[model samples]
Target: MNSEEQPILSIRNLNRQFGSGCRECGGGSGQLIKNYCLSCGTVYACRDLSFDVFPGEVLGIVGESGSGKSTLMKCLYFDQETTGGEGYISTYKDGNANLFAQSSQEKRYIRNHLMGKVYQNPILGLKMDFSSIGNIAEKLISAGERNAAGMEERGMELLTHVSIPVHRRKEAPRNFSGGMQQRVQIAKALSNNPPILLLDEVTTGLDLSVQASVLDLIKGLQRELGISIILVSHDLGVIRMLADRTMVMLDGKVIEKGLTDQILEDPQAAYTQQLVHSLL
Candidate 1:
């Protein structure tokens, strides 16, 4: 690749609006939109967002609850279709291409092989009834690893990497504490060996000590795998520890974005300053 080439993932002018009324008022339905939900009886979940995720870079996206952080991550991962603007994912498998414009089949193929996601709620991303190791191995197989032995080996390695005990690997996630369950979720997300990982508040419900361990596990994995990561969290401390850069969002719009320290130490926007204060 040339030095001038863009990063692995690039999002430009992305917008996502919800509700039926916005659909009628010239804002396309599903992912696109024009007027606010109040005026058109449709909710606007995310609006005019743009960012990039480069290879081996961890970008932290911070916003309060209902600030569209999750929505923006969904759009980048193609879990939610865009209303407008362009999104691109560049990889050796597909070369450089527009993500939103890809056909359903193309998107499915990429999603299965090239990207992985960890939801804020562990239960949302994991099967409560399955053994922790089984859950991770199942995802590996689903992502195209057909070798049983290989899957088991990789699953055990991942479990260990995240600090899950070997014996506990046989236990169902329901038997694990909140932090352990989150580690299992992280292990499962890495099962695919995806080039891009979307972590949506992976540390949300954990206590402070557990959160630190989980964050350390994530940083270690990133160092080993060299995969680009997008971390969505309301916790500034989490972002400060893991992210090289940070983006701040408010009411679906990007209020400020820069290096993590720059934004935290010298916030440019009032919302960003208030968010930092809340952390203190």
Candidate 2:
């Protein structure tokens, strides 16, 4: 593909602000921001952020909590409305089209048809009360794949792909271990056959061994499905293992961005260097 045809997602000058009142709080101010809780005043979560995700490439975003990685991803995926700037997600065979500027109906079409998301907390993505396989099939049907047999077939395939036992397909996710729950979440995220997958701190609560396995599973899926992915994580090791490119964020801005090896081995920014060093 030509350069113009390469990128599946592009973001430019993206900004998001959260304020308690109508007045916007500038980025310089210190404030605590929560996902659902907007404080008494506004807080800037992202500022002039820009990046791209190429077709079939895995881009890793690394930063401490409150650095705006999650917020940026959320905005790109249209989970949250943007305060300013532009973002595009490729929907047609021709090239990328602006997503942020689209009408609500248009954005909804792209989100449901082309994008899938996995949250840091696995339960947020999977229904704890439903059987693991049931949740996966539900996503398939919701995506408009109406054939019940097809949904069941794909659901079982995904469960096996994640190494969940066939017998456990009928068991509720609440009874599974943390790692198992995450595996089921992955299955659900893949149910829609989305071209882009946004993963937020996917392995956060899993043990080291489980983390390694899950990372391996993601890599394998990427190779097999050829879907573009943006993964946000605090774990440098996860970034090093999964990302071809890495972007480091600090204080609601992108401080460094480059190939994963370049950023890890010879970081130029002080904050980037500090983050790399902290991993050692």
Candidate 3:
């Protein structure tokens, strides 16, 4: 992000702990001896994670399974309650208020109106039984849009934007191929033109060719719409293709972060170097 322009979203000391506390493990403080405390079974799913996502930038989070990438995304979207920290979106309250501090109703408003998310599983992101347009309309409905014609028109536009045929708008996502289902999810996520988009391993199970097409569609949409995006994936290749800046996460902590090219070229962390070499 440029020094002059403020980040669209800023996350500060974000923490998500899966257990209450355990004195033997420093009660969620000091050195975390293990992810699970022998005494309390408290799991520190995420540490004091912090990052900023600038408008119109794709910030990629790459890590292996159990690296806490999905957990972080869930916390950001409020699907999983955060244990601690402040989250602010510039589009909300002139960027002066922490999103986590907002009332439940206010939080819902922000989520439905300002942020959009697509999960790895189509079932989570798309309603298999709903028509493609019906699924997109669900978000618009949540945003208080009641005009049926407008919703249909908007859905058509989004489907077209994602390269889905207009005639298929009435078809169920369950009947579409994996790639088509993912495109439907993308359309649904963009239904409200949210400033921030969260994608959690959206292409993990797809064929290589399908993955490439979805990745390309994502890049095109982000550029065309100028939305800030956080793409979580285990694939460094996907991150390299789409991220302007990248954050490397391991065991719930960000080990390294920098321009995508710089991090790939001269990684400082051992884990990051290993990741780069593996790609090579």
Candidate 4:
């Protein structure tokens, strides 16, 4: 990663909370019960989180369930509204504009053009009834492609790039295996050629062999495309395999961050130490 190069994506003080806070827990002054306010019953799913994704680098976010990793992804993708934050994309308005503050139409444009996301649940990212290639076309169309032949050609190229059989391109993702569905989702996500890709627990729940295959595919694609990616996973093994840099989150806050190798060799945080040791 080139430290001198500008980050492709930068997030500042990103915060997402589920409820209005009370006097005690408002403004992040008071806290109780692991990111929850007992008095107000508010959940601070993400708080004052900030990070950057450099060009062609995979930034991993590792955390357990309720660690706010997934919530952070949702905020970045605009799947959920953020309570407060600023996001800058180098390719968007020359990185001068704050993406979180953009108009809804503008956000949609950014989502369709500047970034792609692969959700852990294929249902969230794919239309089950749509053919696999049709799913790719959907994204391409959203990005302003109008020529049917052009879109189909792009879709076929992407599916083949992701190693999905050309013969199965016409089948719905529902008809494919778990790993195949993910491949289709990947192909669809890449259809628009977005600079940034957000992947959330993509390998979770797959069989061990399938998980390895999916991870291998991701590694290969990242190298082949040189696309920047933000990968969210609870498994440190997954992060270690793909992340150039990593941020560890707990209870809605980042407790550690560094190059993946440094974090593994010398984890400063106790929680991070345990996480690294578990892979031994």
Candidate 5:
């Protein structure tokens, strides 16, 4: 790939504002507030956001609760619709076409074939009633892999990859510990070997040790598979462990972005400084 090549993913001026603009709220723009609209009771869960994730790089998005980080991830994976913006996935249109302009079927294909996600809550990522193997199979099935033997083999390989014993492949996630369940979720997400992965607060509810192990697993996967990843986390520790570059968000806007070392050692934004200080 050329050094000047476009980003694997690019988002331009993404907006996901709720409620119609009103005069009292400055038409829902121009520094009216962070999220809520005093005029029309609107919410801007995402607002005028733009960034890029380069191939084989981990782009960390860090923000506190209600900072619109999760919302941005959802929009990237098409879990939620964008109010306005242009998104491009290089694998789809050589990084020139807008992703939101694609048909529903096209979007689904991109999501299924090009992207993978591990939700913070295992429940969102795993089916409680289904066996661990079955959950992995579901994703394989979505991507049109129909051979039962192949699915089972891939599922087993993934389970082992995440450090889940193959013996428990037939058990449901609900039967496992929180960390094990999360491992299963990671297994399921990687079943298809998608090039891009989205991880949303993936270690939030786990214990410190568990969190370390999970983060290590992710780092290993990135190194081994060379997958481009968008990692959304409020925890600076998580960001520091995984991210090559970082984007700091405050009130639905990016306040600072640079290499992980730069953000941690020499933050520019006041909010980022406050955040880094709290970590000490």
Candidate 6:
């Protein structure tokens, strides 16, 4: 939480919109019903999002559905293009480059070598037909690991780290349970040993006991690897458990942000107050 330490990742004025905006809405002068423009029909999914993820820290982004938290994650991971913004990763180009404007080839390099992402849906992150270890190998290969023996060793190590049984390494993710599929996805994401991890609702929709286990696994991984993480979830409880700092988003804008303990105990924004109260 040192203010002076260099950030591993930095985003500035990030914005994403579904449709071309009219002058009224596009100019940031008109009011919208929720996040959609009534006149021009442009949906501003993410607006002016800016944040930093410090080394070895978890920065939680909490928001309701359609609050643009997931959109922000997508932009960061390059699953979706940003309409406008700039992003810098300390591990890339000495943090001098804007990631949003990178060429496709450069973006691929950054995605493969500098960052990892685990999607809420395992299908989005894992190839359902591929063996669990094969999924991990795919990531390893993308990161330029051409030696099959080396990849197998790395894949096995990652699967074991995520608690996936050795015997089941050859099974496809389609055969695994919800929680197990997520574990495999996590293993695959970590296969390249990326410095930054993006986790979008990793524990969502799991049974209570299963959710607890996945959260604990993530907590342990962060502590062991010392990797910076950006975790997006609507669950305040999840943020409380893992995040050192938390940001609250509403209607595609950041309403409040601060240390997790401070926000939970004395939330400043009215919307944040309701959210914190609900966690009781």
Tens-digit per-residue lDDT, 1-280, candidate 4: 3543889999999999998999889666586688999998899999899888889999999988999999999999999999998999988998899999999999999999989999999999999999999999999888889999999898889888888989988999998888999989988888888999999999998999999999999999999989999999999889999999999999999999999999999999999999999988
- For 179-262, candidate 1 gives per-residue lDDT tens digits of 999889888887878889999998887899988988898998999889899999999999999998999988788889999999
Candidate achieving higher TM-score, 2 or 5: 5
Runs off by more than 4 Å, candidate 4:
1-4
- Residue-wise C-alpha lDDT for candidate 2, range 1-280, written one tens digit per residue: 6754567887898888776443223243443453222445566688788898898999999999989999987897788999889776666434455678788887766766788888888777888998888898777776667888888888899999989998889999999988888889888888888989999999998899999998899999999999889999999999999999999988688889999999999999998889889999
Error of 3 at 201 (Å): 0.4
Give me candidate 2's TM-score against the actual structure.
0.89
What C-alpha lDDT values do all the predictions have? 0.83, 0.84, 0.90, 0.92, 0.89, 0.92
lDDT of 2: 0.84
Per-residue CA lDDT of candidate 6, range 51-136, in tens?
A: 88898999999999999999999998899999998999887888899999999999999999999999999999999999999999
**Deviation (Å) of 18 in candidate 1:** 0.7
What TM-score would you give candidate 3 relative to the actual structure?
A: 0.96
Q: Can you tell me which runs of candidate 2 are displaced by over 4 Å?
A: 1-5, 20-40, 92-96
| Every model's TM-score | 0.90, 0.89, 0.96, 0.97, 0.96, 0.98
TM-score of predicted structure 1: 0.90
| Model 5 residue 171 CA deviation in Å | 0.4
Which is better, 2 or 3, measured by lDDT?
A: 3
lDDT of 5 by residue, 19-42 (tens): 877777664564465778876887
Reference-based lDDT, residue 183, model 3? 92
Q: Candidate 3, after superposition: displacement of residue 108 in Å?
A: 1.2
Better of 5 and 6 by lDDT: 6
